[model samples]
Target: MSFDLHGRTQRLELSDQNLRAFEAVVLESTPEGIVLSKSAFYPGGGGQPADHGVLLWQGVETRIVGVRKGDDLHLIPAEGDPIPPVGTVVEAAVADERRSALMRTHSGLHVLCGVVFRDYGSLVTGGNMEPFSARMDFNLPEVPPGFKEAVEDACNAEITADRRIDVRVLPRSEAFAIPDIIRTATNLVPDDVEDVRVVDIVGLDTQADGGTHVASTKQIGRIKVAKIESKGRGFRRLRITISD
Candidate 1:
């Protein structure tokens, strides 16, 4: 399997430490670990967290401590073991718990965006995600009183609804047809990119994205809109946390 440019959504099902033995073609080999033709790893981008996993070569396991994207390539950690030649097969596994936490956090941010956009017609200006927390900036004059609570409640309601999260790639023209998608705070779809990957939260949210997420809102567990702050004129920040 070639490396998927479009991100994956099944976090828990991802093999964590066991993918070291699978076959993979080395696309690029450097002092850093090689980039394989097909990798389950995601190089961090668009404010989302980077993937941490293990790459197996022979009987040796090397930790993938960091991932950086180059022009059409991903730069991984340096190999401490013998470097595999190009076309060599290797196994890759993502850190399961970290990936799962990020999935929940990423999905929770989407839910928050959906609620804020629907209720206030606000657009998200920026955002960042960690393992268990994330924050989004919105182009709103000010966060309304009790807005945080309202958003939390709205997110929980959707999670309880167990809405399915769908991800797929679409042609640029096809993706641009949706008004709601075009109105996202960030221009997630790169202009140079030919195809756009979209994440749809059933009837609640839809936007162009290339981040990992859960298959259903119910997998997000309990979400708390922990804080809301004013960034500047017409911009508000919402901080969120997901708990057990």
Candidate 2:
């Protein structure tokens, strides 16, 4: 399998975050899922959700409600939606409103992750996101005074700085060589994986990530630290939202 292939499908979204529409041939088709030769729909991971869109073929429209990852990337069609037959060349359009919001939200989380680690020296324990909101867990036993306001200020400062956000894939050995590639409390990357996709917030932060992000920190808009909670010993949760 080539580096660009996830199963039998060529994952176009990996190289092009701004891609929203593409044409592809159905290699396999069913109500459950459809496999295409090439697709730009992000089959989400790493705290991001899969993209939703529609497939157009022969004047019929089948809505893609979700994506299922397997040997091949499976575009999960809406229940009872018409499934394109194998070999059908369909025009696919990713739901821009959803994907764009997600791109901003995901990048916002990375900015938050970078700021927290840089200022507090806490490692991320876990994280998740939706269209414009997210929460991240950090391993910090003590809640510093004014921690919430401080993080929000720092995050927006970086966003205002308009730092570049770059994504690249490198061989496994080269990626881990960076000191902060794995900012998580524990390494989450699989040992069998031979390559690593890195998401770098210029000089602020770097991590081995496999999710879509904006072109720069400004594209993330303003990140609002909505709330903070103590889940357990050394576990602190920060809830955040993204706004224009």
How well does each candidate superpose onto the true structure, as a TM-score?
0.87, 0.98
lDDT value, residue 74 of candidate 2? 92
Worst 10 residues of 1 by lDDT: 8-17
Once fitted onto the true fold, the runs of candidate 2 whose alpha carbons sit more than 4 angstroms away are none
Residue 60 of model 2, lDDT score: 100
Write the residue-wise lDDT of candidate 2 on 36-150 in tens digits: 9999888888889999999999999999989999988999999999999999999999999999999999999988989989998999998999999999999989998999999
- lDDT for model 1 comes to 0.75
TM-score of candidate 1 versus the correct structure, residues matched by position: 0.87
Q: What TM-score does candidate 2 get on C-alpha atoms?
A: 0.98
